[model samples]
Target: MTEFRAFHNTDPPQLLKLWHAAGLGRGAAECLSIDAFEVLIFSQPYFDPNGLIVAVEDGEAVGFVLAGFGPNEEESALDYSIGIICAVIVHPNFRRRGIGRELVLRAEEYLKSKGAMNITAGPSGLLSPYLVGLYGGTRPSGFLLSDPLAAPFFESIGYDATRSIRIYQRDLLGPKPPIKFHLVNLRRKMQLMISDDYQAPNWWWLTRLGRLETLHFELVPKTGEGAVASATVIGLDLYIPKWEERVIGLTDVFVKENERSKGYGQSLLLEIARRLQDELITKLEWHVEESNTVASHVALAVGYYQIDTGIVYQLVSR
Candidate 1:
């Protein structure tokens, strides 16, 4: 008989074991470490232990799920409570037995209990912030498209593939692509500034109203020579830490509509890449909406290559 229960203090070791046994080690390397579990999942103040659960068969944990909400204050603004299925791992030995489905259903039930109007089988704990670490970022959002089982599995379990994302990556140790430019003196025309505050452009998931320091960039538009700044944020690039490799994961990049198509986005990325490269933090990565061809054009020009794809799945109560 298989039995399910809430999270316990002693569940870390078994959870980590099951994570690896489920072959999640590739995308979710952080979960392979007990310490990471403490930082990534348990460290979040928003984490709900009651929302964490496990399934056991013959006295062994075969499956587990972690669920929780975004900051409570943002609920009203969203018009619906958004909850995340931080993760769901089922041991390979137990596949085809429907354990994965049971674990997800249970997590959804708990999320609904906490006033969650909709649920995402995406990154949890750290709230809506994606790519904060190796957890949510390993793919794009919901699950890796390469996983084969991911798309169909979530669909069979009542989750809708709400959106698609394209992931990009490049190795700094490899050939560095030349910073090509079509706009004349683009570097002199715009000044790049870096700061951390809520006003910074970042991943949409970062709407939590707290003092979380977000590393962001802003490109000030300059019109004339004497430093008479237009004070317009023409474009920018932003990132968060991925401590394991000391890599700065690109979270967002944007250029004002009128400022776009002039090869400005690529130039902005070049600036961001140079700053990071100068600090020996050469590696950078990020994702864009699958339909965003304009963004993809600049990313490719700046040496970023297509790496993986992930989907965002959602289920609404009504």
Candidate 2:
């Protein structure tokens, strides 16, 4: 008999091994580390270990599922939930036993009990009605499963592709900023631009949730004396629990249309790297719209490599 129970402190090492065997990914591997797991359990407000369910058979853990919810800024309600099925790995020996389905069902029930209005799962490409039944409908930015099996499974269950965001990373050690470009710290120059009248406050709040610091603004010069130019805000988030190699996440890099192709965006990124390198950060990471070709090109020009894709899905409960 298979029994599903809450994940406990004693389970990290074993869970890590299971995740490794499932060929999850770098992010999952990083999160599964014993130290990382402890930090997530204790420090993150949205995480609940009791919401993490593990399946055991004959005294060995064979499968697991995780769920949680957080404040929905869009709705201004604390009851909004964003359920993530961190992983649902079944021991190879336990395949074809219906264990995965049962695990998902239990996870969904747990989320509902916790007052989650909607649930999101990383679906295998293979079609499965059971997976689709979890949500009233697939969210606008639903999670994407690269695995051949997982993709169809989600589609068969009713999840559809809404949009995809591409993750990019750039190494800072190789190149230096161009000498001809003048780099100005926008944070000091554009204090007037960040007005309460605009959505700057909302952006600032969201950046805080992502643990970002060092918000910088940039301006591009235009031809006429009275002509208004393009502006952008670049923010950085430092990853915590400082390891041997520290990294910085560049979140919300935006530029106005008038400034395209003038090298301001690239210069701003270079300035950010130069500033943070003194602090010992070796890598910079950010996400961009997959469809934004110009932005993608600029990122590539600045030595950023497209690494992974993440999709966002939204669900509204009736």
Candidate 3:
């Protein structure tokens, strides 16, 4: 017999045990500490005890599901209309017992009770409300296909795949990819500005990335006052033990609307890669929507290769 209940303050130890027993993939932080959970999940201002459902049998946690809401269009506050089932983990020993399904059902009930009209499983982009760096590389990128269980489990539960996320990685120890002759001139014309003191542009940005040690890179034309492109990255020093390499997760890549098709994005990425290489960073990880051809091009132009993919699932209407 199994009992289900909301998370208790004392459940972290049991939950941590269940996490390792569940066999998550490389995208997940394997060496996560209780403090990591506190900073990444429990410490968030919007965290709700009721949003995390825990399954217990023999007075020990066996499985769990975490649910939360994304920010509104303005990124100012939670939009109850949209609810996200961020993660579902069931202990390996408890497999084939329907514990995972029950956990998700309980998560759904919690979301629906909070006025959610549209529900999504597997957090991605701004839809992500928890476990950003802890689960996915750099940012919340749905559920990685490397997990094997994610797609089948979610699809079997009536969630349809709506978006594809491509994870890319570049080894910075090797020589940087060569740039075009035109790009060389462009590089000379633009300044690559790197800074450690980046102020978040908005409340949502602050909420998501505030805790990480962020590095901001901007490409600006020598003659202009505005940046043509910019990118944000955070060091994954905590992952060094698990990955056995120094890593940085790249996110919030952007280019000015008027700067599109002018090679600014590609040049910015190459410069960023070069800088990371010079600093002895071993690897850089980035993810983008599969439909984003421009970003895909930029990443490939800088010698990044697809290392994995993730699927974003949405709950189908009855």
Q: Write the per-residue lDDT of candidate 2 for residues 71-126, one digit (tens) a residue.
A: 45552434434454534677667766878777767777787777666565542111
Model with the higher lDDT, candidate 1 or 2: 1
Tell me each candidate's TM-score: 0.76, 0.62, 0.97
lDDT of 1: 0.63
TM-score of 2: 0.62
Q: What lDDT does each candidate get?
A: 0.63, 0.51, 0.88
Off by over 4 Å in 3: none
Error of 2 at 240 (Å): 13
* lDDT of model 2 at position 176: 53
- Output the TM-score of candidate 3: 0.97
Model 1 lDDT tens row, 48-160: 67788899988788889877665545343332277777677788888889888888989888877868776787652234532244443422355777555667888887788
Candidate 3 residues 251-302, lDDT tens each?
A: 9899999778988888888888888887889889999899998899889988
Instruction: Give stretches of model 1 more than 4 Å off.
Output: 30-32, 71-80, 124-131, 138-140, 195-214, 221-246, 316-318
